[model samples]
Target: MKRSRAVSLGILGAAAFGLAACQTEEQTDAAAFSDEQSCVAAAAQSGWFTREDCAATFAEAKAVHEETAPRYESQALCEEEHGAGACGGDPAAASGGGGGSIFMPLLAGYLIGQALGGGRAMAQPVVPKAGGGFATPTGGTQLSRLNSTGKMGTTAFAKGPTTAGQPPMSRAAVASRGGFGGSAATRSVGS
Candidate 1:
């Protein structure tokens, strides 16, 4: 009887651990701003973020945008995904020895989130979507507008795969990238 009870308790503990692992991701306070000045302005009033935090996070977001924003083989394809006037020539590709002209969406905004453990803040770059919204580089999170504040999953700050130094994506490749709603599919550049 004693051994049976111990085994039952062990099973229950394991079940509890498994359930905990399936819990939803933790949420954090986050906000979106169209630019650094706007974030700084909000920081002065909200007290959740500081001016320094705004600047640093915005810079980080810009770098992430340049590194991770999806690249297209043509302006038409990029515009199709990002909307007209929202796409631009890839700066890295234009600098020389980049193979050919590449296009990508412009950085539409930035998201700043309170770190889960309360250290420094976190940031993610947002780009314009075809239907008039904003999304992270991975298209895992979408927001309707900038200058908004709310609770967001910590995963919103996660960086997407780097597109820098990679071959530009063709229309079919972009169609199949499948990153929306966090259901990203990994595929080789040439495949």
Candidate 2:
């Protein structure tokens, strides 16, 4: 009887651990907009956000884009990762001490998510992908289109490592670094 009870307790503990492992990430209401104007327009319809929220989040996203977007050694390499016409010379490199050879993707859009505990909305900037769609700087969250709303994991708003002042990545280095490769599971909520 004692042995049976001990085995049963062990099984229950294992089952609990399995259930915990299966738990999904926390989700929040999220929306993507191609520009600040679009976000402001949508703010009227989305009770979760306001005009002020749109302005604030858009600004925050742009700053995040400038700081965290991947930097490559050439426009061609940047374009190869981001779609053609989406690549641009790195603004920091041009203005700062970094080499002029650096390039980065243009900001395609921004994602705004309602804070889980009801604080200010969270924002993440997105850049164009090689084929189609947009992805966060870390390429951890992907969106099929802008002007769409859905539930997204809270992790989508997490900031990526800053690349602003770092040395531009060579093609081989970019491949090895892995954030811009879209390796994370694509999590698209709506169209």
Candidate 3:
């Protein structure tokens, strides 16, 4: 049946979405790992110690590094540019702008995606309905509807349009169905 096909489509779409979500998560993890590695490399180059030095210091390098961040700009810059230096080098090396290497970009992308949508799903739409009642396919949103905002010139949100081949409507009817005109900020179907 056509309804069955619709159901299948919905299921397939959801599975695909779930897979894509997993991929994005994997990418995020990879990004974080990359940052940690880069930080290690840079730290070695700047001194204030190394894997071997940490062994001598105590054997746990990560803990030492966290406590050894520089407190001065000149010291941080020196270590950053010239490679690892003495533990007493500078006070600012640890600051490193709160230490962003590669993970920040991936994390930022994920946050933006969540903000654009995702917090609210399976809700009603903002557009008038052709069936004289609110009806929208679950998880059916246009790329533009979700992503056409942000730095782009498009608006952050838009009222979706009704599908073609339906009946005419009265202004009052359209207005009433949306639960608007009451000033209570009704949450519409397509919203």
Which candidate has the highest lDDT of all? Answer: 2
lDDT of 2 at 37: 100
lDDT tens digits, residues 24-133, model 3? 21111000001223333433443232333222322222222223221222333322322344213222222444442211000101001111232321111211112121
* Residues 39-94 of candidate 2: C-alpha lDDT, one tens digit per residue: 99998998899999999999999999999998888899898888889999887788
Clashing pairs in 2: none
lDDT of 3 at 76: 34
TM per model? 0.82, 0.82, 0.15
In angstroms, give how far residue 87 of model 1 lies from its true place.
Answer: 0.5
lDDT value, candidate 2, whole model: 0.75
What lDDT score is found at residue 116 in candidate 3?
28
TM-score of model number 1: 0.82
Segments of candidate 3 deviating more than 4 angstroms: 1-162, 179-191
Give the lDDT of residue 42 in candidate 1: 90
lDDT of 3 at 28: 10
lDDT of 1 at 77: 87
Instruction: List the candidate numbers ranked by lDDT, top first.
Output: 2, 1, 3
Taking the candidates one at a time, how many backbone clashes does each contain? 0, 0, 22
Best to worst by TM-score, what's the order? 2, 1, 3
